[model samples]
Target chain A: MTDTITISVDAMGGDNAPRAVIHGASLALRERKNTRFIFHGRQEQIAPLLDEFPELRPASTVRHCETVIAMDEKPSQALRKGKGTSSMWMAIQAVKDGEADVAISGGNTGALMAMATFCLRPMKGISRPGIAAIWPTLRSDIIVLDMGATIGADAKQLVDYAILGSALARCLFDDDAPTVGLLNVGTEEVKGLDYIKEAGRVLTEASGSGFTYHGFVEGDDIGKGTVDVVVTEGFVGNIALKTAEGTARQVGSYLRSALKSNLMSRIGALFATSALNALRRKMDPRTVNGGVFMGLNGIVIKSHGGTDEIGYKSALSLSYEMARSRLIDKIGDTMQRFPIKVASEAPEAEPEANSA
Target chain B: MTDTITISVDAMGGDNAPRAVIHGASLALRERKNTRFIFHGRQEQIAPLLDEFPELRPASTVRHCETVIAMDEKPSQALRKGKGTSSMWMAIQAVKDGEADVAISGGNTGALMAMATFCLRPMKGISRPGIAAIWPTLRSDIIVLDMGATIGADAKQLVDYAILGSALARCLFDDDAPTVGLLNVGTEEVKGLDYIKEAGRVLTEASGSGFTYHGFVEGDDIGKGTVDVVVTEGFVGNIALKTAEGTARQVGSYLRSALKSNLMSRIGALFATSALNALRRKMDPRTVNGGVFMGLNGIVIKSHGGTDEIGYKSALSLSYEMARSRLIDKIGDTMQRFPIKVASEAPEAEPEANSA
Candidate 1:
């Protein structure tokens, strides 16, 4: 039998709170052969929900605490006041004490990032943390980094991001030497601001050594699966992620409206159930919702903002796989093996034929 | 009878270049009666294409201008050295000498923006120019501004962009009072940086004055048609525009690939043609190809980057509508009549609520 993979879940986070989180956790435990979940919130609030599931038994399954960081809370504030928050404290404490193999939350992203940085701290030889999200393009899936961790970043940071993203791909997707692509306005070597141009050179020169660095990719290629990993600054990444979600929602809504316009549309939809379902399965965000926070000491995946039960369950299951993969150590070791040389810190270093 | 609208098109621009541009122009002229097109390229080179059509019997038709700007040419250099280039000379001379009503080119965007800004300066009170694009959102088509021009803008500049975008809506879409929304991270009172926050305050305080200025809106709302005009800094605007294009392309490609997965998919597609076609029509970028360069003295529109004849034709039709609507003069007079009092430019001059 497999070892009991106990996990601490933030039951108070997400739009659907305890009910959704608890329901997902219990579902996860039931689905897996051997697993346990610690639901963190308040006793009075979470007790009834835990009791609702008789499969979980009397009440030893959930470990209640106090406080919750609302979705709208500023990230930094949540990190500072994390001690009082039951979800934050329980998650971090479980990991710290080795009681839980992983901690999962669909809380405010800013707060989660801040908490991860302050509590777990970065692995050795890492500066900034990045969010690794799976974008289902046409060819294959691409892991995009720094979705919203840091607002502004330099060229050196972006190069490092590429390295980190590549390393995470090795552990996650099992692509030992994954192809990395830099997200940019254009594909030219000299395109983008000085920051991006310099970063491209770094990625190009350092390619094949550790990471299989591709040249550049546009926003449309995010779902096309052109590359395994795409690296960009947090600001651009955040904008891209939000724009994709928004646009998809807009198109999906529009398509639904068009198809449900009248009796004719209803008739048309009847013949195309299989095709529509195929499209639905492919476009469903839950199919690729879990986004790993790279360069962190532990595995923490963010559930999509409007995540329902299926999406929440996907995040939890993804976290469990990540822990099984020994994700943290693999990324850390890969990074330690080939640390990036930053321009800001590597002053007076040998400049090998600057492409610029 | 409507006045004959004359247009100068850059034949040596875009991926398809002279061929696509020529076909697009011909289609526009053939389709519409009161529209005349002036092709700006080498006479000898265009002569063969003209011979094929044999419709250009009038000697005053095609303007003989040589030289072409490569897509990769540096923006500054292209703007400076391209004085004699076919596209540049045609656009400048056409607008400057009133030879053509407006100049349209799908050339290098940076160079186009520079030419448009330097040649056709903003109407009287306009400090900076903004590019307005029509987004096919859920509710209806909304005008998004500062899409490519004005990189890092202040609060008042964004407000100015909103006003310009609003005016474009009024002139083109015939919406008298377009609701303006500031593109932001969140909708909270203090969300985003100082520029966005201050812009929100101005937009909120200046409600019911000329255009209906709505509060801040998230990026996702772009597709919902929540607001008629969406304004943001050029960086964000450019990213948003690119993201949308990229996503639509990705979805289209993915559907094609999924439909070709196997015999089942192909067979499924056969039955799903009606539903799939309905989807294609809604997401097709061709239906909405023309993007207006707002806050300029004349009606200038930019076509798609990888656009073919269909997209180019759409741009031509849009240009015709702009000419028919007399958008430039109306917007120019509107701006002059109600000068938006920017806090920085006119801090001391506070016009009473009545004057607006």
Candidate 2:
């Protein structure tokens, strides 16, 4: 018998929790047959939901957790108060203890990150963990990382992100070596911050080691799929991700209004139902719900807190794919090939003062 | 007789300059009866293009320039080589010399800003000039500032951007007290850098003095048009702008492919031509081509370097409206009413070190 991948689910996390979490697990199980789940939350609440899906009962085991981290709780507070007893902490603990292959949560991002870092700790040679999002591009899906995990990063950290993001693309795309790019305002050599520029130099040197560095790419290049992996500091990466999401929703609104403006368009929309459905599927955010936390010892995926069952299922699917690929090992191997130097040892090759 | 708005044109700037510049000026003259242009470029290039538009010849005069700034020229190189002789510099000087009400360019962003700041100088009580882009939103259009004019900004600079952006909204939207917001990673009080947080405090105190402060707004709020002016540091703002553009293009590409996958959808696309055209018009980058350079002594509008005649015409139209509105005086008055304190005078109320 094939060894089943165990997934730890934070049942009390997110807005539509317990039900969404259980239902999502059921849906994921339908697609990924060789899987087992341990739901961490109030066992009584999870039991009733699991009863609704009788088939999922055999594959899932409910673990009682008394505390629920608030959706808006501070990261420091979450870490201090809900260290081991909270549902989120317990789910992450499962992965840390090697009881589960990966953990999935749709909780407050800051708290989730803080707790995950505390439980799993950073991988060797990795100072901090970053979140990598799989973005749907024109050519195909691309991986973009450091999506608001931490704000500004030094050149060494950015280089680490390149390795982390490349590892993610390797797993998702099933390619051993993925083309990587540093996201900047312009593709010109003189553009962006010093750290980005320095990281570019480092990535260039590490091209043949595992990943292929495509040099600097602009914001537009991300959607154009100019590279398989796009690396950026968390602040710009977060803004870019949110801006793209907002723009997609904005365009969808425009399309809806345009199709409903007149009878001719209404009839046209009816005829183009298949086409519009395809378009909707391409634009659907739920299909890419999970953001994998990289540079950590264990795997953790963060789903959108407000997502429903369908979105949660997508996140679980991501978790399963990552576990199957042994993404952590791939990242670890990649890091070993190109060991990152600490910031203290870095040469003071600072860029010009007016560069910014 | 009404005082004609004399516009300075960088006729040799963009990819399709001289012709586009002349044609756009003619288009502007059609809409605004009281406007004249002093086209700065090689006279030989301008004279022939001017002959193509006979009506424009009567209202336009070509100023011979020995140098033209290359579209890809570095700011430092342009400043050193082109100096006062380049078409871009001459146009900006026209505004400085009060020979033209405003200057418009379809040239390099860095070169334009470098020259404009050098020629026009920063406005009174302002540390740096920020580029303000008018973004189309679900509600209507909102102004986002510091779109790569400079990189990271201090609290005082951010507050200046708010005032500058507010003054712009007042001119364009005709609202005396436009609502303003500081762009951040999250809307929470503790999120983002201390500069943004401190700016929030300052703006809160200055509310109703000139503009209505809406506090912090996240990236999604930009598309939702949650406020009239969205203020941010250039680095994040530029990334947001470009990311939004890329996403729009990506979605458009997806729509085209989806609509052409089969015959039924092709027929549907044909039937929905008018509706699609409306949507296209709304999403057209040309319609919002102008990026107004604010916190400067004189007005300068930057058109997209790769834009067409229609787009150039839009930039010219913006220059006309801004000239007519006496935008510079309004900004001056706003600045005088709310003089920002220098950083030296700021209280030592720094945020915690771990905030970033």
Local lDDT at B77 for model 1: 65
**Per-residue C-alpha lDDT of model 2 across residues A1-356, encoded as one tens digit per residue:** 13799999999999999889889989999999999999999988998898899889999888999999999987877877788999999999999998999999999888888888878888877766889999999889999988988766778888888888888888889888899999887835243377788888888878866799998888888999999999998878888998898899999999999999998888888888999999998788988899999988899999999999999999999999999998998898888787445362333222111111
All candidates' chain B TM-scores are 0.89, 0.94
Global lDDT of each candidate: 0.71, 0.86
Clashes of each: 10, 0
Model 2 chain B: lowest-lDDT 10 consecutive positions: B347-356
lDDT of 1 by residue, A24-55 (tens): 76666667746677777877878887678667
Among these predictions, the greatest TM-score belongs to 2
Candidate 1 scores an fnat of 0.32
Candidate 2 CAPRI-style tier = medium
Off by over 4 Å in 1: A1-4, A54-60, A76-82, A187-192, A257-268, A343-356, B51-60, B122-128, B187-192, B257-275, B337-356
